[model samples]
Target: MQAVEPGGVSPYRFLLVAARLGSVRRRSQDVDMIKAQRVEAADSALIDPAGSEWRSAPSTRLSLEPTPLISQPSAYVQAKWETIDYGAIGNVSVQALHNDGGIFFRLQWNDATENDDIRDTDQFTDAAAVLFPVKEDAPLTSMGSPDEPVNAWYWRPDMETPFSVTSEGTSTTIRTIDPNLRGNGAHTGGAWAVVIGRALQSAGDGYVQLTAGEEGKVAFAVWQGGNDERAGLKAVTLEWQPLELEA
Candidate 1:
């Protein structure tokens, strides 16, 4: 165990705290002092069970070392994975490289579960979505009808999928779609996407809100929760295409 830093107040200075959270007793319970005193802004970091690789965080001096903080041989294998609960809003995207070598991008949306004022039940009830492109600062339009809840519109993208689903009840993949089908978070606020085919984050791998003022060269197809009752992608192929800018 490392010596604890005194009176830690800054969120970024939190590397001073260390906890071997992997340890838990099946027979008895123990209080983890490390998690109790964490100064990091997000609790998800210390507890992400799905983190297969060690990652260095830029905000703090801490390096999320290979788990099994204790020398016990079985410790690493015992940690429980945390489930990710994310809400969806219909997403718009852009995906082509400009002739000048700069990438173009765009997007807009509203989440059904995010806010009381903005939460629209059209999705969970009927599997619907909406789109607001950056061009007009567009208003929310239905993904389908409120009763049926689905429609198809092309948002351009710097389309690339790092992996493919290779299982039943799951047909998920990507294909290059259009150009000038631009959209992004510049109008909203904090956002993250694959810009110009690169994973971007306003703050490291985070998708907070979108800002229209901020544009990028990548676009993503955000699948709504209701689309997969099986808890995974369950379709043939997610359609994508090259959308040339309109003349």
Candidate 2:
């Protein structure tokens, strides 16, 4: 074996460097490929915060692409594939409006199938979620770290109401369902529109409080029941988009 020079790089270090570079390249590509979308102040605020009033509101549409989940699989998820092909949902339209002390969001997406039944492990139901960082600088991927938690609002057609979930690093815990966290969904003409809303303040620990005119970040995810998307096998946004509340 050849003698090594002082301060010379090791093979392990070289591999780590290559991995980091690859990640940066992928991120840059995503930024270019993904078209970031934003919500504007509605002409008229939602008449019913959790209702279909958003249909009349102007929409901000965003293009969504399938996530390449390359990280090590968690115990709850057995699949180790880098990408899942669910005939990917292409885009989603979002609308937002705020009132006396809360904010509401409406998300619409097109799906060829309507999967509302969840009867077995193999059977999955259509679902969607909106994520916000507890801390302003929290990581957007892998939920979030313990120090930088993420508040997730999940909705399913079968559920009467939406529920909140918190994620710290790789761990996730379901929070109590709040009546104040209201949601209404409708599926029509091969599409689904969901309206969800919550108070401007945190209901408890592990929640993100929203305020009017304050800047925040958000991300979205969708699970196609017909395609067998469950757990970490769903399509997701590659990065967080800016969420600016109306004053």
Candidate 3:
């Protein structure tokens, strides 16, 4: 019955795993080092990991991340602020995409109107005749190309934002329209839906996992008619923090 070595553990030691682990690996020189490590780790014998000890760490000792600053528009979010404002084309209008080629959307900040009495409005209206060819550089109002045809597509302001896009066979998913429409009914079908998304997702140009968001992109492009596709947006801006929702 006496299987244990005289210098080793006794049968009673089986009750504890530490005892079963054999003597703690201890070197005479390491003894103080181990004790110090244990002191730093446990802080106190009464505050072991398994034990519930609410030892408060010093503010200086604790890892404290700096308050982040979001000044620029993010990929996942777009915010904008404007004191002076005027659309390149008079009256609220929609840009009609009449071709299959790509397109660009743009925005410009006109400081000239900064002194003018600017009326901030959530609802902007456009006439039946859309403000065709919105993309422009420099002064921006010059327009891209006039010859491009106008096609009818679906659009809703402050609609649902698209988090993901995929295709199955010949039919392209194109782009999704927002379900919830915001103020001002002008740009509807045959237009592009606008939603809040990250203005600048610096993570990289890869498919971000679809998740809920608060703010979304101003609008999106969709091809309602054949050849008419959601072209690229040129210069939109973000000045204020945007309320958005994610997919």
Candidate 4:
């Protein structure tokens, strides 16, 4: 198939040509474009869906990270990083649900050692975060730029509740803790299970607004204290995952 020059042929002819010969170069470029344009998807935390309930919702594993990444605290390169043995947490199982005017999430993970106590700078605490875009087309990585911000729901066992933050690039500011946002966690049998809940909309400025039947994107990150995986040194999804609310 011969690649059609833009403006020289119609899309119909472009498809017909692509089907007939499908030039290797053109086909390869098309595939690349598709990947670049397509954002990966995941099941949104359900809203009052019936099943085993929030605690028993189906689990989805998230295990992807940035290439050539560095740990924020240690400044270790991706290949040489020893904490979590270079993304050793493997994957975290997650489930989400909403009820009584709020959305809830259950994140579970297995760790041989639990680092819940964070009393010193040398020691780090186990933590996780979920980031949602303030706007439909907000960038998942970089926590969105200034013009495009993101709302982050962060949880740690040491805290009585999760923290709501708005971020642009590397700059983040603590925002009002929405009365509707709160979460708790427990560690048992070398594993951790945490539940976080928040309203379906942004509480105020620089927050994402969630609604039933709406679609958006979310990103996940996890830090292992035992491995000194503090700051930027953590496991994270490489790209945005689909988030769609059920009516």
Give candidates' CA RMSD values in order. Answer: 21.7, 9.8, 29.8, 11.9
Q: How accurate locally is residue 220 in candidate 2, as Cα lDDT from 0 to 100?
A: 79
Candidate 3 lDDT over 18-114, as tens digits, reads: 3455545333321111000111222122212112221331101101111111211243322331221112221111111101111111111111111
**TM-score, every prediction:** 0.21, 0.75, 0.16, 0.71
lDDT of 2 by residue, 77-181 (tens): 446342335415656777766663666777889887888878877788888888888987777657788788999888888898888888886646566677567
Best by TM-score: 2
Report the lDDT of model 4 for residue 202: 48
lDDT for predicted candidate 3 compared with the true structure = 0.20
Alpha-carbon runs more than 4 Å astray in model 3 = 1-158, 172-199, 202-247
Superposed Cα deviation of residue 9, candidate 4 (Å): 39
Model 2, runs deviating above 4 Å: 1-56, 75-84
lDDT of 1 by residue, 188-245 (tens): 2333232221111122111212232243111124433343211221110111121222
Best by lDDT: 2
> Candidate 4: lDDT of 128?
82
TM-score, cand. 1: 0.21
Candidate 4 lDDT, 94-113, residue by residue in tens: 67665435566677788777
What is the C-alpha local distance difference test score of each model?
0.22, 0.66, 0.20, 0.60
